[model samples]
Target chain A: MTARLGPLFEACGAQHRAALIGYLPAGYPTVDGSRALLQAMLDGGCDLVEVGVPYSDPVLDGPTIQAAAEAALRGGVRLRDVLSVVESIAAAGGRAVVMTYWNPVHRYGVDAFARDLAAAGGLGVITPDLIPDEAQDWLIAAQKHDLDRIFLVAPSSTDQRLASTAAATCGFLYASSLMGVTGARDVVSSTAAELVGRAREYAPGLPIGVGLGVRNSAQAAEVASFADAVIVGSAFVTAAGAGTSGVRALAADLATGVRRPAPQPA
Target chain B: MVGIQPVESSTAVPDARGHFGRYGGRFVPEALIKALDQLTEVYTEARSDPEFTARLNGLLADYTGRPSPITEVPRLSEHAGGALIVLKREDLNHTGSHKINNVLGQALLTQRMGKPRVIAETGAGQHGVATATACALLGLQCVVYMGEVDTERQALNVARMRLLGAEVIPVKTGSRTLKDAINEALRDWVTNVDTTHYLLGTVAGPHPFPVMVRDFHRVIGLEARAQMLARYGRLPDAVAACVGGGSNAIGIFHPFIDDPSVRLVGFEAAGDGVDTGRHAATLFAGEPGMLHGALSYLLQDSDGQTIETHSISAGLDYPGVGPEHSWLKDTGRAEYRPITDAQAMDAFQLLSRTEGIIPAIESAHAVAGALTLGAELGPGALLLVNLSGRGDKDVDTAVKWFDLLEDK
Candidate 1:
């Protein structure tokens, strides 16, 4: 699994395009429904998919994702159900990762979670709340299981923190485009480019995926100009609410946007 | 009765990574790590600085009224089968609760950190009112996030906060309760880490918060111990307090931890009853899980999803308890019991009628537990209960519960 992310990014780089990453809470609305939605996202051109493990309290999520998570939880989705969703996505040849808060993983036992997630064919995990400094248990577990550990870098992160976080991260650096919770915005903050640039200085050649506000195709194209991956969550969650077809259509549109040539310097 | 003696050590809690023996830690986003570090550094410095301690103590004395008296409730104890009951009068504080102690301390820390604004999350509104009062006194901008449902149930407190110049935001998100409000406050802190302070109200969040808030309220036990000794020449056999997020319990229990003869007890709200699955008895009926940045005993289902808790008292209707309390329970240093809503309400009215002291429904849980404990002890047992807050805010709830407002 640790060997999967590099090739995914390199392949996108060869195509002169940014990888399109879509997010959906596992078992949202229903487990089967969510699995099908994730497959639709991949079918519609998403290079990678993030299956969110719904937590009771998601501090970093906005209302859209929070609602989705609540619905998933209401549907009785557990960690095993999440791993099953990832398994289905992997069996279908879709590159999938589990994005979750740290507590669920901690409660599930870090080593057990890593072993099970790897067994389910998960490429890596995106821990929105777990920082590298306090993630020693997870660090050791992920390394032991040969699973990728993706860490988030916020706009507020100091240089020292960014370097340490990047050093510990396995797959890619998740650069939050803004300082606020995860949600869509009409305008992607200019801070995303600055953050990506800063992360690059500390972790040269590492893939930086910009998330937290990239909503539309235009915003995706704008972020794709500098970021190695355009990670959109709330927008996809909003679309997934309508149907799997909606998720597929949005993924296709976002995929095209990421591939569009960066606007010639005006 | 055991004689009161000064506890040997003051700060043994929260090892380097903030774990109270595998319970607490900085399980937060990367964005908040720097803020937590800065807070820990400032708190460490403030803890040792004479000027800081003096200023905080002065404010605690002059503004909030420290050294709250302990009252022996013999009339109430008569109903407890001959046992003597003493009440730690935290309810007599200026802001009407023990929460003021923690808010004032954090507000001072906010000023020391040079932050101009503070954000908090509230459930029953006592913490919100206390935070608003402190922020007003210190001239700091205050924003409080409350669950939309809580805002409606605790309308007076919402108005009180607004009157004190704090902005009250009704969060209409998940569960629409304390947990959601905390989520919003954390988001705000992460977004405005440079200029704002998240003045957490309870001893449940990540490191520094649990330890810092506990230190602020430890004065409760310290003062109570001295007062008990000065008055009765001995320590009470048992100390009890209501546990929502376990602030008041920890406050009164910390100083007595070394007193081997003194039994520390915490009463959690059992909304209907633990058997009915509608209760907030996290330590009693809950399993270990993580929420709001700390791994603690939480009311969760088989899938690790947090179960919505119920209590007549909005303050105690939370699914999680403080991590330190979890550590205490596991170490056999403390015992936690569940009190049903009916039992707590019965004690609420009983205290009012017998002693003319209107206890908050939250505190009444402890009062109810003390009654059972007193009866079990048979006779001559001395129990000190922390009257955590006044019942003024719960009058409407009481009136409705007993149908006092019905045309009579």
Candidate 2:
């Protein structure tokens, strides 16, 4: 069954313009704090929220997200705990997805995982390394749960690969802004616009969300201008930690600037 | 219709999701998350492309020597209480171990991705030599990051890799060994992702890698399966191999994962002893923790920091086993037990004396396990051991262990 995610996006008022996406590491301070942070992000105008399933070794994460995961793990946040929190947030009128590595799902059991995650209020799962050819069983399980299995894209992807990812992914496509690990960058990819433009051809009408190192309003605005959605992960995760209000304010401020029309290159 | 095997479904547990019953997951940074996602996208395309699998199999045959033989060691079997002993001789492969299988596959993938440079970290130098060999053959620039201590101990391997045109960088930070070298390699990979490919040595690390490496090494079990059928007419009673990062053992065990009758046993090094506080028996003594980018059984303390490991063999001196092995042990698909340094040394000497095969210290652990089981199983049962590598590079370590280096 095709996931009817477009309506959800439209219902969230993301149809008319680029959606502002925020990311938070689940159980950063505690489960309760993550819930509050997620709520605050939504209230502050985030159209969608991505919750990171804190894992022990975050190889592609920068210092900020890494520290957040360490804190979450220290707080006894297992994969099940993350799913429970997702259910809680969704119960409280929020739309969220899980961003995690592929192992936790394996450990949690794939078919059971998709069902439990769907039951716990997750709309989709974004597993960065579950190569498409290998995803059939899990995808079938995900489809059984009616959960979206989002795919990612980069400048390195060929046209054929982009098409495969687009065909496999649902909910929205996560387009990496850079090739490196997640962290703030000094400059944007000179090819980010082109990458999104190419992905558009592959997925056609799928909503494209760009992320990885978009730490500020300027960067968010630039990304939003190119794609259907702008995803801010490391920056939001760094700022909106357990007890910090700085992240909330920063996210809100960036939220305003992201919706504003970006300046065209000369 | 695809002729499916019964145990095959169990072996591919995560199916496409990359799970090994809850222990295997991607625990990577968010920045590379997207890149990994992109990689999964490309990998999916490659898997279905017939051309990709054909090319991979072709390389395995033409370059790395596909269908590595299964040798029946009647003399050694008699020594191990007359149990039927068969050696899945990965040691006979071009670079003398199963590590080449994964490197060749990754090097091909790197070329397919249009990457130019290959980076790797080595502790015992087998992986470095294999990667360097693959790079030289493929004409890719190879940089091998090795720990300072390991470089000093395995100096000959450094020379070997350098001769193969790989730049050997001695990492000096942290414990100044394999772990540090891995950290440095990851740093290099992150910084140069556009042009460089990291040829991880084992079936550990983040997602896709364990899956990818295991897929490449499947040839080991695949070949053994057919050869064993031809030689013995049916499946064996058990499969035995040494476990460090668990690549060789996984390579052999993965193909037999669905063969419920094939009892899979992984032998880990016990250094001095498992309980004696000096060992690399991660599965025996380690707690569940994170290291080298995945949550696996690790020789780490309460605070999640890695502990120093001791093994008479430099190759087996690591504080962690591969993540998939951790899952395997937990799920009871494989049983991981310990072999003390003395026992391994004894087995190493015995193999040399009995078969004229001076097995690598790491492979000695498997020899020790086979002997332990062979004595129990008697002459009728069959045990397949992955004779992982040749022992020439480990001569100094063996000489010192046996006190044979008094004057020369």
Candidate 3:
């Protein structure tokens, strides 16, 4: 089983920057091509990698990710194949985790999936659909397998909800600044800084990462100014259309964005 | 292994956490939880309020046409080997289907929630039209997401929705089917939840939805049971309905679950056949998996991806069913069987010819099942089938299938 992701976040803290996290679907474009994409994210300076397990019905995702997932499914990606990508991500020295909707993992046997993910050296899982309210089976399995169970909080979260959600999370908290699905937007919402501020009150010790529309470096810098980590998803998927080099180049740019100094308050 | 036995208990299921014996729960993104909790809270309060109950019952009685008649099919009984066949005529309801019952209740809930707009996803467009009907009467803006393929197949319904002042968006993603439409609707809900009420169209979906939608449609079984007792003096030998998302099936089946003498049979749509891997017979062939916010029997590939489903009846072309149906199947309280397109179409034609009742293809699946079941039960057995909808919305598809329209 792989250890928790605590040390990696601590290292990023010491470096005085929000960690650069990049996301890509496993078995997208093609089986081998996806492996190249993961390597590119790490090579291009992503501090951590979130390998998405493409699901058939992704309600929380927009068109781009859904198209990529559909293509991945057409290419016959399986749960076992996804684990191999996670294994490669860990072996390449980048922090590794998986992002998937809950059903596939539950169908694979919750305990068995956690055990397998740990064996693959993946640190944790980001479940978009499996909220803390209905995570009893998952919580037990995660504990037994020594895996982190990261939960998400949106801008819509109430204070009580924020506290409860933060209390249940094991690794860093994933805070989607927007209430909408994943996609590249023209401008980032300003609500994220406030959401992160509330989360900081509820979970001061845990690192908080923001996602759900971090497309370019400017948006990345804006988010990183307050957040502990900057997570990019659908934008990276769009870049992968130009192949692995496109992904590497974008990852490098976002990494630089995370390192850029915050604009001072007036 | 724990020895499997039929759990003969109360039909009152989907407890507070919305679990129908581990089959139903809130499997949704965090952003939707607050709204779900609020819905649960509001629905619970409404249920206990006399004014709310009275007003909704009043709408069901007057506007939606409640206590739909029990029509006997004497000529149709000949095909069932002289066995008696009667129907709960939900086909006679306002908007021509049982779908009106749930939509009216949800539309009322939407008004209560102070949401000015409603969004829904539909397959055959029965629920979409029904939602549009309710929204028009109640003065709420309506938008329905339908699969691109279904919108083309059931074009009249799209026109009907548009005429009723609802915007119909054709979803072009994920095999262009009902499940894809649901995904699109959820995305809309995630983004515009504050101003919009989802008004989910079936007995399937996350937490309170399976329970809430079922309660709304429970009137079908409740009234049918009473009507049968008052008119016929006995319960049915068997009660049958088609299972799509299992809304209409569970609606009628729920009232009869405690009656052990009554056999509950839900017929699923088997397009070519279940063996052909082109069918929507989830309980017959699928494994336990979560899809569309509930853990139920879903037709999925080995890797747990939902597979595309095929059925002559667009209403029954869904990969997943209500979670309560999963519990009923697991507990042996109800049995599900598959009826192929040919059998359903044959029954559809027979009912039209023999009884002058043009049933929906979805309901035709149930009629086909009743014919086989009546033969097995023999001469004196009483069978009650819930004719879920009228065939008006299906005329175009039927015209193509039967080649009735002339090219002259």
Candidate 3: where are CA atoms >4 Å away?
A1-3, A264-266, B1-9
Supply candidate 3's per-residue lDDT for A145: 87
Residue A25 miss distance in model 1 (angstroms): 1.4
Best by DockQ: 3
Determine which window of 10 residues in candidate 3 chain A has minimal summed lDDT: A1-10
- Top-TM-score candidate index: 3
Docking class of 3: high
Each candidate's DockQ score against the native complex?
A: 0.68, 0.09, 0.86
lDDT of 2 at B306: 63
Q: Candidate 3 residues A1-266, lDDT tens each? A: 33397888889889999999999999998878998998999999899899999998999999899999999998989999999998987887767899999889988989999999999999999999988888988889999988888899998899999999998898889999888999989888877889999999999788899998888888888898999899999999999998988999999999889999568345
Scored against the native two-chain complex, candidate 3 gets a DockQ of 0.86
Clashes of each: 0, 23, 0
Candidate 3 clashes between residue pairs 3 or more apart in a chain or in different chains:
none
Candidate 1 on A172-227: residue-level lDDT in tens? 99999988898899988988889999999999878999999887888889889998
lDDT of 1 by residue, B65-127 (tens): 887889999999998877899999999998799999999889989999999999999999999
Which is the better candidate, 2 or 3, if ranked by TM-score?
Answer: 3
Lowest summed lDDT across 10 adjacent residues in model 3 chain B is found at B1-10
TM-score of every prediction relative to native: 0.95, 0.68, 0.97
- Regions more than 4 Å wrong, model 1: A261-266, B1-11
